[model samples]
Target: MPPPILVTGGTGTLGRHVVARLHDAGRDVRVLTRHARPGESGIEFISGDLLSGRGVDAAVAGVETIVHCASSFKGDPEAARNLVRAALRAGRPHLVYISIVGVDRIPMASPIGRTMFGYLASKLATERVVAESGLPWTTLRSTQFHDLILMVARKLARLPVVPAPAGFRFHPVDADDVAARLVEITLRTPAGRVPDIGGPRVYGAADLLRGYLGAARRRRPVVPVPVPGKGARAFHAGANLAPDHAVSGRTWEEFLADQVGDAPAGG
Candidate 1:
């Protein structure tokens, strides 16, 4: 039998869906996670921390395709470095990385930049690691996921007044949509920096939050607040949008309706 495909962060918001697609396609999948998990049919869970080098070599052993979906608010480049080092020792494998769209466009250089936009810098560094890893690689940069937007909306809704960052907009796509694309990339020859994937529509911060609140049967006033810094300033110029590549199905309203409750897709 051929070796299984390895998916880092196979249990995360995006990684789990990638694992599911591979499993459904009759491909054996190995998941590398920081925490211990039980293996299911055709899907084996390997306990390995990407932040450290532990268990990573074993995780990469005999795998031809590695879908790198694991990420954090910080330390993403470190994790990618660890994975790259191990992959080099193991063998040449197809490394497919998932990154956000504005990692390159945003400037994460100052105090506010590091505080609010540091994650973009980390991801860009990770992308570099993958590209220069001496292995065949494919990278996909997507807009914010529906799950992420949903979480933010839920948190801000807890407050009596939700502070919507002015001039910020999102093209939130479904995690499953991204996972499907990852699976396609995994099964195909390595394509460097594929065209971005974004949601069907773009929604402003206030509109997005209002949609979620309406879906959840909650009412909260969304007030616009000026976001500070050059990074945010760059983002306000639509660094986070991908109108040309808005090929993914599943709108924000659709996801919110499903997550919160029955409501109209339009808010």
Candidate 2:
């Protein structure tokens, strides 16, 4: 029998898909969550909190592989450190982490870096922990998820005018696709850091907002707000895009279409 694989953040957007894929494959899958829930079917639920390191060791016991998917803009660094310690104590499991693209390129020393500091810093710290943990590990850096783009668009749509960061571009990949890749990675030997998985195409923030508005059948004028910063400069320079390595299927338009359905009858 294959050793049970423990999955942190198994209840989240991407983690849920990973759990489902692993469970369907008939693998011994265990999920860690803050609240204990009754196991359904063959899936096991282990109660644990990555932030406080509570119940973590118990969750790692007997598990040979861990897919570290749980992350927080505020607590990721500490949580990752805790998870690494627990894994080491429980016999150095193969650790796989999901990270965002362009973190390496984003300046951690500037004012722009300080703005989105929590999230970027935490994730960078987590990556370092996984790398230096002396355990077999793999880290997959992927671009922003399409759902995130939609969330921002929805929130901005509430305003009188949709304001987009000028010169900002994104290559938003689908969460499910990223999840599938993670599953594939988990089944193989750790490959350390792999090529980034990005969306089918790159689009500027204004174009993205227009796509969202078109799909939702809402008309809103997009105003470009120039955000001057090194971070913004990096994003504008395509640091967030893996054009040479555009991987994964599904485009932002496809995702929007699925979510909003067919555009209202074109006049």
Candidate 3:
């Protein structure tokens, strides 16, 4: 049998899918989590915390590869550095880190950019950690997930009129598609900083809001409000898009369809 693979954030949105895929493919898989449930067949769960470096070494012990899907908006850089240290001490396993697109392109002055600056900055720091760790590593940058987009939009749809951020665009890829790509990457040798993975199509904020309203059977008007900031400008300039690497097949509409169980209420 091949060496076991360690998966951090195994219970997370994307990590769970990767774990499922690896398990289905009959690979020996171990997951690191803060809480490990008992009697879980076919998966070895280790109690660990990446942010504090607890049990990380134990999690990496005898593992050949690590699919790092865990991240925090507040403590990403520290968490990543800790993970890198643990992995290095454990013979430098192949590390796969998931990142967001436009981490380098989005200016910090924009509203959206300002709000995400801390998270993006931390991710950048984490990327640097992996790159300079002298370890074989692959980092994949993916666009926003469809579920995230809908979650925000759905919340906004609760108002009488949904307000869309002006000049903002999104390329919302399905989480499952991103997970599959991560799994594929993990199965192969590490490829450093590959091209980004984007959704099948791009949609403006208003269109996304309208889609949410339609799905929830809400007749709220999607008002395009001027969210003028450096962030909005950056997004308008296509900082959020991966025009060269739109590889995913699932569209936001299809995701919405799945949630609604048919076509949206009106269309």
Candidate 4:
């Protein structure tokens, strides 16, 4: 039998799509989850956790490639380190990591950033480990996911008026698109640091919220509130925007439209 491709965060937003892509391509896939279950037609699930190292060895065993999309916004650095240690022990050859763009440039904004902070720092740390571990690896940095906009919109909709950070810019890419890119990287040679991936268009936070309002058919006033702090500064400066090597794809409007159409009525 051939060695299967192991995917961490297999049940997550991006991970699910990645697993499906690999399965569709006829590649044997094993997904690491908290609970192990019977193989699903073409995919295998292994119960494991990166923190405690529980079932990691078994999950990684016999797998030649690993797509590491699992991450904790709170303990990303430590989580990444733990996963790398296990991967080394299991002797996996290729490691592909999904990370966010502007991790380096952005300063700590919220408590999450102050703690785990930019995914760049965590991912860079892990990338160093993978590079030095003598394992073939690829690290992909991408802009925010399109789903994030909808999430923000929903949260804001709960309030009578939407109060958002002022002057914040984002390049939101589709999760499926990012997953496809990651799978493509896995199938090819391991490039240490691939080009950054970003959405086709760049928009301010207020603009994105307006689009979301229109798509959801919810009329609400949007108020832009300027935040005071490093996080706000980073966003206002367009740190998340892609100046060069912007990997274009579906815009936020397209993604929101699809999501709104699929959602149950009155949702």
Please report the candidate that would top TM-score against the real structure.
Answer: 1
Collision count of model 2: 0
Pairs of residues at least 3 apart in sequence or in different chains that clash in candidate 4 = 113-117
The candidate, 1 or 4, that scores higher on lDDT is 1
Single out the weakest 10-residue window by summed lDDT for candidate 3. Answer: 258-267
TM-score of 3: 0.94
Per residue, candidate 2 scores C-alpha lDDT tens digits across 1-267 of 888899999999899989999988889789999989999876899998999889999999988899999976587878988998999999989999999888878776776667754477678888999999888999999989989899999999998899999998888898999998999999999999987888888888999988889888888999999987777788778878878767659888788888876533320
Q: Which stretches of candidate 2 lie over 4 Å from their true place?
A: 263-267
TM-score of 2: 0.95
Per-model TM-score on C-alpha atoms: 0.97, 0.95, 0.94, 0.89
lDDT of 1 by residue, 150-239 (tens): 998889999999999999988899999989988998999999999999989998988998898888988788899999999988879999
152-253 per-residue lDDT for model 3 (tens digits): 987887788888888789888988888888989999999999889999988888888888777767788788888656666777898878868886577888
Weakest lDDT window of 10 consecutive positions for candidate 1:
258-267
For all candidates in order, the CA lDDT equals: 0.90, 0.87, 0.84, 0.80
* Model 1 stretches astray by more than 4 angstroms: none
Question: How many clashes in each candidate?
Answer: 0, 0, 2, 1
Which candidate achieves the best lDDT against the true structure? 1
Q: Please give the lDDT score at residue 141 for candidate 4.
A: 86
